[model samples]
Target: MRYTVVLSYAFTPAWLSLSRDERNAMEEQYIQPVFAKYADQVAARFFDAEAFHAQHTDFALLETEDLQAYYHLVEELRDTPLISRQYLTFTDIRIGVEGGYRTFEVLTRARE
Candidate 1:
């Protein structure tokens, strides 16, 4: 079964105070590394909320074959400055509903 995790993150006061360069450095030094570590296990997509939504600053959608891999990735990310320095003020995780995308995948496989 495929698992999908959708995240809606709001910016914190700490993040708002940082300069552009500081944010870039944090992404390069901390955020990117966590994604790299889980690259083989999960595929991630990010959306800048302003373009499509008004409630959150950014959004992350993660897809993985193993649900545990997603949990591990989140755990590692929480340990980084991304979470520690309060870059995110609020977070909402939406667990996938198995019957939606999974149904399409299963039917496609059956056709083959």
Candidate 2:
């Protein structure tokens, strides 16, 4: 089985004040390794932008064979400073298996 995981980040007011290189460096150093550790069970890709634009943001797509591993990866990421301070969103998860249909479920919290 294979799954596609998309992780996106929207900057907060404080995050917006940082330089692009600063933010990129932080993500590269902190986040990339975490994703890389599970590279065998998962394959990951990243997207980054120079500034905050509705159409532009940082994101990652992970292809994984283990759903449990994927969930664990998400949990691990949630604690990272890069994610803790940013508005995070994940989507485009699809399961691929022969002779079966693909499905996924996501639970999102409503902002206060």
The estimated TM-scores of all candidates read: 0.81, 0.63
In candidate 2, what are the lDDT values of residues 1-112, reduced to their tens digit?
Answer: 4567665655566776888888788778877887877778877777775375474466677777788888888788878877676634443344444323422221222322
User: Which digits, one per residue and each the tens of the lDDT, describe model 1 over residues 5-76?
Assistant: 888888777887999999899999998999998999999998888577667889898988887888898888
Give the count of colliding residue pairs in each prediction. 0, 0
Predictions in order: lDDT: 0.84, 0.66
lDDT of 2 at 106: 19
Model 1 quality (TM-score): 0.81
Candidate 1: stretches off by over 4 Å: 51-54, 97-112
Q: What lDDT does model 1 reach?
A: 0.84
C-alpha lDDT of residue 33 in model 2: 80
